[model samples]
Target: MTYIGRFAPSPSGPLHFGSLIAAFGSYFQAKSQQGQWLVRIEDLDPPREMPGASSLILNTLESYGLHWDGSVIYQSQRHQRYQEQIDSWLASGLAYYCQCTRKQIKQGGGFYLGTCRHKSQLTPEGCSVRLHVKQAIEQFTDQKHGVITIPHQLAQEDFIIKRRDGLFAYNLAVVLDDIDQGVTEVVRGADLIEPTGRQINLYRYLNQPEVSYIHLPLALDEHGNKLSKQNHAPAVDTHCAKETLIKVMLFLGFTLPDDFQSASIEQMIEWGCQHWSLQQLPNSLASSTL
Candidate 1:
């Protein structure tokens, strides 16, 4: 099978260094294998999305020479696809409605007690849809991180697939789209490692082929917090694209040749693809300033 990979980013804010590193890692992983690379705008949450952020992200990727293989996919326009999966899950005995609030779950030791799993009468007014996780996905091997195991207690909880506000949950939408796009590998940051088991279970629940995963080390600030839009991480300077790419490469633990330091964006990417290997990547977060 042909290799396929993606860099799916939420439009909560502009593309920051953390996001750039993720895009860079995924891009190299796909291109190095002569595979198709796709970009997905995860614009499912309207309230968190900033106007024009999606366009800016696409432009930034292009400016940095991380071109996608086909038309960029917008999750907002694919509501029908997400809805169909949810409807199917509800019809089958795979998923059910959840009416428990955050406070209720917290009171029950912070994990869902599956309170509504047996309730037949559920009103859509304030109910969310949750996947009934019957089996525990204790462990799965990551291409880079090696044997990653979810705690048994956390693996058996019925997690939400759709929010009460009618927005498709990240875990649900991502799995469905990965299946729809025929993505063979998922390469992103280590911050999303915890969600991998849930997504894997969803793949099994839907009876689809589970994609391979490789999570790059996270870029953290001096304080040890991961750089994120929620923490107000500044957007990357695409005008200095080459310099930015160098930072990402160094963070990923590559020693560039002195001659290649002055290479253009396209040259850098080509060189990166030729020289990059997942085994060389560091497993721990490296501190850096924007």
Candidate 2:
């Protein structure tokens, strides 16, 4: 089977150093194996999305020599596809309409206890759709981290596939998109590891082939918090793309040649593909200062 990987980013803000780490890690992991690396713009949430952030992200990737294999996919354009899957699940009795509020779930111990699983007749206007979750997957092996076990309550809970506001949930959309794209592997940040079992369960529900996973270590700020756009982590400097690329390489635990400082961006990337190794990556959170 052809090894296919992807770099998916939400268009909520500019790509930061943390974002670059995920992009490059996925890009080189695919390139190293002569696999196809695809880019997907996860523009699912309209309220949280920033104007023109998708274009800026694509431009930044291009500037850093991280060109992808095909035309970028936008989740906003795939609403029909997402809805179709939800409809199929609803029809098959695999899912149902839920009227449970966030406060209600939190008050009920933070795990949804299938309050609305029997309420399929609930009006869709004020309801979100949730999977029945008969097969709760509690464990999966990560390519980098190995043998991860999810909390039983989280794994067993009936999770929402669509929001009360009529938006597709990330877990539902991401799994369907990966299946549609024929992705063989998912290389992303470790921060997403908690959801792997949930995504895997979705794959099982759809009877689709499961993809392999490699979650790279998250980049953390000086305060030990994950570097994210919400935390005001600065966008990567495109003006110094080469330097930033070098820093990313070092963070991934690659040892460059003494003369690599003078190498062009393309050359550095070429070298990276030729030398990429999963074993070289650091398992702990990487400091953003690097």
Candidate 3:
């Protein structure tokens, strides 16, 4: 089978160290296997998206000599596609409208409690779509985290597929994107491990072929907060592009050569892709160095 991987990043901020590590790791992994690497803009979270951040991310990747196989797929432009999928799920009774609000759910221990599971009528407003979740799946090995399972309550809770405001949820977007892109391997930040089982359930429900998932240790701040836009992680310095690339390569488990330490961005990418190794990556978080 032809291997395919992706580096789907939410454009809430410029590509920071953490973001760079994910991009470089996935890009090189695909190249090492002589597979295709694609980029996708996970812009489903409208409120948090930063203006111009997506364009800047693409430009930054190019500066570091990490180009994708085809056109970058943006989620914003694919609303109609997501709606069609949701309608299909609804028609098959695989999903239903959820009317629970924040206040009610908090009292219900974070589980949806199936409050609206039997709502006879679908309201035009004040409802979210939820995938009827199932029982705990048996142990499945994460390429890095060893055997894994979603916490029982989380795994069994009927999770949201569309928010109350009618926007398509991340869970729906990710699974559909992978299926549409023919991505066989999903290499991404480990912070998303909790959601893997949920997405797996989505795939099974949709009758889509399962994809291999490898969650890399996240790059965290000293306080151990995952480096992200919400945490105020600084934007990457495109001026320090070459040096930044070296740090990310090292973080992804590549040893830099002393002679080529002063090499240009293209040379570093050439070397990085030639030496991608999944074994060198740690199962825990990689803290960012300033």
Candidate 4:
């Protein structure tokens, strides 16, 4: 089977150094294997999305020479596909309508207590949808992290597939999109490691082959917090694309010659793919400074 990888970013803000780390990691991984590297705009949450952020993201990738394999996909345009899966699950008793509120779940010890699993007959109005979770998957092997075990409570919980506010949940959308795209592997930041088991469970629930995973270390700030849009991490300067790419490569544990500072973006990227090694990557945060 042809290796296929992707970088799916939410349209919450413009690209930052942390974002570049993930993009470059996935790009080099796919290119190294002579595989297809795809890009997808995860615009599922409208309230958090910044206007024009998607276009800005694509332009930045092009500016930095991280060109993807084909036309970019936008999750906002795939509602029908997401809805079809949800409808099928509901009809087959694999998922059900949920009326429990966030506060109620919190009061019930944070993990969902399956309070609504038997409430399939409940009205859909003002209710979220949750997977019945008959088979709880608590562990999976990561290409980089090896065997990872999830807490039993979390694994057994009947997680939501659609929010009460009429938005699709991230786990459901991501898994379904990967299946639809024929993705063979998922390569992203380690910050998302916690969701691996849940996504794997969804894959099994759908009876689709599970994709391999490789989560790159996160990019943290001086205070040790992961750099993120929520923390107002500044957008990376595309004018310094070459410099930034070199810096990112170094953070990923690459050892380049001093002359590399003058290398063009294309040259740097070609060299990166040729020398890509997962063993050199740090298992913890990449760095506190870019």
Stretches off by above 4 angstroms in model 2 are 284-289
Q: Give the candidate number with the greatest lDDT.
A: 2
Q: How does model 2 score by TM-score?
A: 0.97
Candidate 1: which pairs clash?
none
Tens digit of per-residue lDDT, candidate 3, span 160-243: 899998789998999999999999989887777778888888788878888887777678788878888789988888888877
Candidate 1: misplaced stretches above 4 Å?
284-290
Cα lDDT of model 4 by residue, 10-83, tens digit = 99999988999999999999999999999999999999999999999999999999989988999999999999
lDDT of 2 by residue, 102-153 (tens): 9999998998998888874697898999988898899898887788889999
Clashes of each: 0, 0, 0, 0
User: Model 4: runs farther than 4 Å from truth?
Assistant: 284-290
Model 2 worst lDDT window (10 residues): 281-290
Clashing residue pairs in candidate 4 are none
**What's model 4's lDDT at 289?**
52
TM-score of 1: 0.97
Kindly provide the TM-score of model 4 when superposed on the true structure, using C-alpha atoms. 0.97
Tell me how far the alpha carbon of residue 46 in candidate 3 is from the true structure, in angstroms, after superposition.
2.2
137: Cα error in model 4, Å: 1.6
